[model samples]
Target: MRKQLTVITALVISFASVHAQDATIEKIREQGLTQSKVMEYAFRLTDANDSRLTNSPGYFRAANWAKNELTKLGLVNAALEPWGDFGKGWDLKKSYIAMTTPYYRPLIGFPKTWTKGTGGLKNAEIIVIKAADSAALEAYKGKLKGKIIMLHRTDTLKPTYKPDAERWSDEDLSKMAAAKMDTSRRRGGPSRNVVGSMPITTRIRKLAEAEGAIAQLS
Candidate 1:
């Protein structure tokens, strides 16, 4: 009789716990449906706090707002914690580029992060640098001054064949769900050669700066 009573008590307690969980979940659902601030939060995070680069002014604004918002929402220990020392934050105030030689047409371009700006409006000539090797760059060393440089070749636009949006097929879904881990790659093979070797892009930028070039366009 004692064993049976203990079993019954355990089952009653389990059912009561499940019922409480369901009631709490239903309350949450009702609150979300009635007082949803999803759109408001999204607007504040994205539209209001635009240009959220790390450690930038916009980033701090968003972070402070988020911390306070969480606190308002009854979350405990809502605060900003520093990760470590980081470089100076950069933000773009204004950007403008245009073609003037052949015809009057505004060019679509944005300043790269950590790139030095041209200070003000510049009407410098654009030069395409097609150096095959670092040795070939010597020829244009003195000539790049006051000129905008393009290090790489211009890209050719390709037409897209796939639709913008589509539902996944049965085969695609099956492949995604049944995917297994790829164990072919070894843990830590010999790392690629990076020491004392500068990338071609970095080399180009360094050369351009050393030669007093106005700016480099990708």
Candidate 2:
């Protein structure tokens, strides 16, 4: 009889505790739904700043703006704290690329980051090369001087009918929660040269530079 009474009392307390938590969560949900500045805050962070790479001028500007905004909201100790030094900062000023020969067309591409700028607008013939391996590179060894080389072919893109964004369903969440780590499969082994040294991607870039290729389309 005592054990039964103890179990009943414990279940009653548990039910009360659950009800209290649910009430608190509902209150929070109501408050969030009615009064939320999430969109405004998001816009201020993202739209206000063009780009915010760590230690860059844009990053510092965004940080300062955030600090000022937080201070306005009566937040204490809102200041930019110095983290350890990141590498040298760079900013993109003006970048443009285009195809002139065989009917003029504007090329849609961004300049490679942290690279030296082209002196001015350069007009060069685009040469497509297939140099997948060391032996393949030899064919274009004497070639590619002062010419823009294309390393890869253009891929055909298909339009998707599905919506770009959607909220996760309960079933989706359950599946994600129950998902197990996949550890069975192993990646393919590295390609080894005759000297047993792994041929790195840098070697190809170096070879292209040695051949006097102006710029490579990655």
Candidate 3:
């Protein structure tokens, strides 16, 4: 039993190592364009589709669209892998955001992919909560049980304002390397708004019984 377990563990680790080596992530990183491709894909997917609907005929259209693009890019065996059963479906056809009051302005955001639609209701009041500490958090206990929680930390927005490119001298580069890089990127700050979907059972499919809100805006 011990020898068999050791063999199994070795095989598992070997398979993991191979998987890591063959990852598309590693190839993209090697090309030094992970950030650029992300933006390009984001624009192509979200902006091109205007997707913020559910069972969106557009969503399935976009899926087929992606399948075509993936095959074009030489991803062998690229195809839609459908999961067993979602008796009904949903998808986004369009999304719009603006501050209608307190001065009209555009709210900068991209909807979380596959989020449910606004169901013909074009506008809704946005409830913002600062989920910071015990007291501030408690202030929102029952209230925020269903409201959108917008965390106010700008940790992930790094100081990306490099005005000009230059080759630093060895001494300058060495000194820069001595200082630690920023750690803010390690903080997983954004919340996944997973409550857009209405729940399902064999007999009934009810609206999202959110722990309290219609949707999480963030």
Candidate 4:
């Protein structure tokens, strides 16, 4: 009788294990393991299928389409809200520049994003300047009024045709990656602000204007 009881206990344990496995699978399915189906449609609607450009008809169409679609998707009170005017927009049709000094090198540069448009026909001698603030700009203030100023520090690109890792082994790469970086680089610290800060930059720009410095090349 004891042996029979042991056999019955073993059968009960085996059935419990089988029941647990089945429950786990049911839970996974109920949790919507394939709910990634929503993401497929979502990406198509919000990104891939939408054609938009700020202030353009395509942009407007996408905006309204999104609002209407959300409303249809059981969004209780979907509405297209009017916000502040974001001003006008323009696209760069074409632009070109070349260096005529130091060497006849065709220097390559692109303006910053979201900057005021130059109407594809504006051309002037580029004046480079780097001022930390208003005062530093004063040194050449009067001069920069009509000049094409480069406000940032100019960097000459060196020819590094090969990848840096090509010159080092795996151990060297690890050592370089693990090396401590410090602030004493470039031979100067905060004192390197030759032009000064923003307010100082404005002051310097005003001074430059007074001194007849054409638009500065920062």
Question: Which of the numbered candidates is closest to the native, going by highest TM-score?
Answer: 1
Per-model TM-score, in order, reads 0.82, 0.69, 0.37, 0.42
lDDT of 3 by residue, 1-218 (tens): 99999999999999999999889678877776544576677676777776635456666666777888899988998888877766565644566777777789987766676556656545455656544334454454455443444544345856776767877899998898898877676756444432221121200111123344456554
Q: For residues 1-218, write the lDDT of model 4, one tens digit per residue.
A: 99999999999999999999999988889767755456765664558645465765556666777788788878977776768798874444455566666557665665443445455544456666666654555565455655665566556888878866656789999999999978685754566455355556566556556544434434
Candidate 2, residue 7: how far the Cα is off, in Å: 15
User: What ranges in model 4 sit over 4 Å off?
Assistant: 1-33, 37-62, 71-77, 83-114, 132-135, 152-196, 200-218
What lDDT tens digits, residue by residue, belong to model 2 across residues 89-114? 87788878877767788878887766
By TM-score, how accurate is candidate 4? 0.42
In terms of lDDT, the best-performing candidate is 1
Candidate closer to the true structure by lDDT (higher is better), 2 or 4: 2
Q: Kindly indicate the candidate among 1 and 2 with the higher lDDT.
A: 1
Backbone Cα, N, C clashes tallied per candidate: 0, 0, 12, 41
lDDT of each: 0.86, 0.79, 0.60, 0.63
- How far off is model 2, as Cα RMSD? 5.4
**Candidate 4's C-alpha lDDT?**
0.63
Q: After superposing candidate 1, which stretches have Cα over 4 Å from the reference?
A: 28-36, 169-171, 183-198
- Candidate 1 has what TM-score? 0.82
Q: How accurate is candidate 1 locally (lDDT)?
A: 0.86
